[model samples]
Target: MSYGTSFNYETILICLVAEVLNLLTTFIFYQVLKIPLFFDTIFIVAVVFYLGFVPAICVSIGYSLINSFMWICKTGFFDPFIPMYGLCGILIVFSTWLFAKNKSDFRISVSITLLYLFLIALTSSMCSIISGGLIDYFHYKYYEVTDMMNPIKNFSEGFIIQHYPPIVSYILAQIPVSFLDRLIATFTGFGIYRSFDFFMKRR
Candidate 1:
């Protein structure tokens, strides 16, 4: 937590790598698979299971084992942080799934998706802010870096005030992305059909 107490570069590196991998995986799922909007809700939920329950527990334990072998590793374990990240992933997934499952029709689905998307964005931003604040607190306590606390506090306040506008913008952005994904999916079937026709003619 402390800046002066020898920062865990390895842990930060691993987390950044994991985040990049997750982002790429998410993009592939959304763009390449082109899953239907209705089905995306379910897919997102399943992905959360993989990220939270599977990878976090597995990767963290593995990292911890390696770290424990090194005499210089400070924390020497990873179970504590892994469970927190896993729990957050579970909450995000479960909330989206529950909201999606409740809608019974197209109109309801659109309405719920918009509402849930906004809530998710807001909650995600706020949670990040809060976590940053907690990390700052630890940093200040451990390293006597009072300046770090101020920035975190400012970020938390700003997020609380401005979270809704960004959330709304993100929901609006998703409207087009969802439509495009489905359109691509439809076109993929057409392309396959045309290819089959061409092959038959050649034969």
Candidate 2:
């Protein structure tokens, strides 16, 4: 294989490792801590601090890959779903990082987390809409409701005239998820730091 081939292989390996790590972290948070969705922000933040951009990028890419694979295996390799999952991960991580960086005090952190959750939900909803649209395109069928449009359709025709408002509402709904994630991150970070300190003191 040429250098390009080697690089491609390496990229795939990295993506696989990242996917495994992402799943492992999510599982631990869900099973051990009994919380999911909320702690994802915390995990991403921790990864950012410990491993920086590489890990963040890998996490996003890995998430996309795993989700895409699942979609493919379950529903046959649909093209729109691939971009939908992949792009959503990237956007979520990017938005989360932006909010995390702006956080200063506890209040700020909370606010940021809430904002982050809102943005995530909105982006996710949009992605879902895009995914649905793609499905409709490929299948040549009209969807009565896309993810972002469902609530509006259910409520009234003019309930949400544009996609952006629904995204905002979705993000607001994710506030609790963000709060839970932050709480878990704090406890986990303190526990690990204290353990390290105790061992260092003895040494």
Candidate 3:
């Protein structure tokens, strides 16, 4: 391993842990909370906060692949939002890596952590909305009108669907939930990693 281009073992390990946590949260959301999409970007953001740009990119690539694979296995089709999942990593890597150069800075103060969480929320919100719009576009583009009663078959149910102005309604409906989901995951993931890091240091 060299200085800049070495294999990021630590990043890989943390990303794996994050992936496990994502699975758990997915169960909680769909099985319990009854949400459709998986909402978790905290691990990726936390990784960027610790490891910087390159590792974050790795996380994004790995996370996107894993997420897409899992969804395809479950639903027997490809999800339209794999790119958005990757986008979350790109946003976190660049935003946090450019803003905070060192690991210590991320955990330095409560304010900084909150700020980072807010940024993750904002980024996730934007990506989710854009992805939603893209998905809707593709859905409508290939839509085969079966009957007048239900022209939009297999369309995702949301405020945006069947609305007068779908794009605006969809975005507006997505923001509140997206912000809250990312914010919670950001805080939870950051705290879990930092706490684990603290114990590891003691060991």
Candidate 4:
């Protein structure tokens, strides 16, 4: 929520790097591999651990906006809904900052870090479901994907057809996938942050 009163090229550089890495991660996982998981938030989470809340949130927003722009360029149509998922990244940053800000070293212990990562995964998954539900309601109310290739989407549809609420269905279907996705992202991001911090301290 607050960045100390300072402006520096190094901060700018860090944000730029995080933004690009987030974009590339998204592209590789969601586009090239056609994976259902969104690995894009890895660098954003890393930024939160490296810098703080403000820089990480800025990177998240920048990544979302750039992603939307790229989608427009590729499809020749803008999907406003694409950027709305930035909320997921913001939630992840806030959750991570809340957990790590109190610790002096932020290393804590492996067990504690794993617990925090699991909570983050749960939190991010719920946030994503809510955000996605809202976007669907406003933008794609009657939308239906006929040939859903993603297993999560396919599973979600099973619940939807059973007269369960779409939002609930989405939450149930995505929790497992999102939980695993976020666990990997936060774990890897934390490792990257620790490595970078170690090298910088040695310098």
Candidate 5:
């Protein structure tokens, strides 16, 4: 995949718009409403369904970098670890590409759509587990940062840690959360993709 050729000026502009809208969506859900779920990948998945992997990956990386910068700007805390979560976005891009790409049509059956969402959610859950584990490993092994950003996730991990190993606890804590988040993101992403396709076709 020659991403250099794929990433033209138009692609860059679209990715920038995706990143800005993603940032807005995330801020609305996470900061304004205090929602724990990260719907940040909706636009990235949409880009995957609409454009392709390269453009979607660009949006994903942009989301991570822009969010990291925003976090530092808001809190004055320079945690370079924020961009590590972009692994989850890359995972979403592939999952969407494989299972949901170009499948956004009004003629598609509800059962099949549900199945696609479930499969994407399952894959995304695994991705989040792996990414979170790596981030936590690096954080504990190298950095002195002890602050847990999400108290609910921290509490869930703490509770599960008593019964299972820390790794298992971490995985368990993230599965439901990641699953729900991806489920919503995949559904909304495809819906938006379908809407755009429909509008364009009408035009």
Candidate 6:
């Protein structure tokens, strides 16, 4: 199967605006939910996952940039946790696009979800590195400039380092939440599309 190689100007604008809105809703939803997952994941996957490669990439990049900026605004500086949203977005989009494009004729099996869940784990392992093992490396760089503010961060870093290697433990710790979240996101996205189709049929 082939994928579109370019996005039109209109497509780019739509993705930018829509993703911005998604980010706001995500922040609000995350505050209320007890589950440990990014709130926008399902919406992003639902809107663009079946649109194939180009749209998925566009939404992922746009969403990630805005999410990073929001984190900076809230925390008064950049946070490692922010960029992970982009990585997860790409994985979720690409996985769904690949499955949809390839299996255009049939229902996706249970294996597809499980396989992408594994991909989520692999991508998140890299998140530990990107986040500097829960900001351990950046602590010395940014924290000093911030005047060692936020003792909670300092304590968490100490706890992470003292008991287990920060990077390893960080990755292991996130797996369960990320796995469950993405699984539900993928299926919930399917339900959303089904609802849309039903409504259109009624119309």
Query: In order, how many clashes per candidate?
Result: 0, 1, 0, 0, 0, 0
Candidate 2: segments with Cα more than 4 A from true spot = 1-18, 27-43, 77-88, 95-172, 178-203
Off by over 4 Å in 6: 4-21, 79-81, 103-162, 198-203
Runs in model 4 lying further than 4 Å from the true structure: 1-5, 137-139, 142-152
lDDT by residue (1-203, candidate 4, tens digit) is 45421448988898898888888887778778887777878888788878888888888889878877876787777666667767777787787777655545446677877777677666766676566545544443444433322336666767889989877776676666667777888888888887888999999
RMSD of each: 15.5, 9.4, 5.7, 2.7, 3.2, 5.5
Q: Mark the regions of model 3 whose C-alpha exceeds 4 Å error after superposition.
A: 1-5, 8-10, 35-37, 79-85, 100-109, 131-163
Ranking by lDDT: 5, 4, 3, 6, 2, 1
Candidate 5 structure lDDT: 0.73
Cα lDDT tens digits for candidate 2, 38-68: 2333344344333344556566675656655
Could you arrange the candidates by TM-score from highest to lowest? 4, 5, 3, 6, 2, 1
Best by lDDT: 5
Query: What is the C-alpha lDDT profile of model 1 across 41-117, one tens digit per residue?
Result: 22233222222233333333433343334313544433333233333334333433333333243145666545554
CA lDDT scores, all candidates in order: 0.36, 0.45, 0.57, 0.72, 0.73, 0.55
Query: What's the TM-score of every candidate structure?
Result: 0.31, 0.42, 0.68, 0.85, 0.83, 0.64
Taking all chains together, the TM-score of candidate 6 against the true structure is: 0.64
* Comparing 1 and 4 on TM-score, the stronger one: 4
- TM-score of candidate 5 versus the correct structure, residues matched by position: 0.83
Q: Which candidate number would show the highest TM-score if scored against the true structure?
A: 4
The digit string of per-residue lDDT tens for model 6 on 1-203 reads 56643577855665666577677766665654433455566656555534556776777777778767866887777766456546556656665665555533334666765565455434533442344334543444444423122213343455476786655554444455455665666666655655655676799
- N/CA/C clash count, model 3: 0
Q: What is the lDDT of residue 105 in candidate 4?
A: 41
lDDT of 5 by residue, 1-203 (tens): 32222677767877788788888998788778877777789888777877777888888888888888877897788886778878878887886777654455424788877777778777877887677665655554455553435423564557555876655565566666677888888888877777876887898
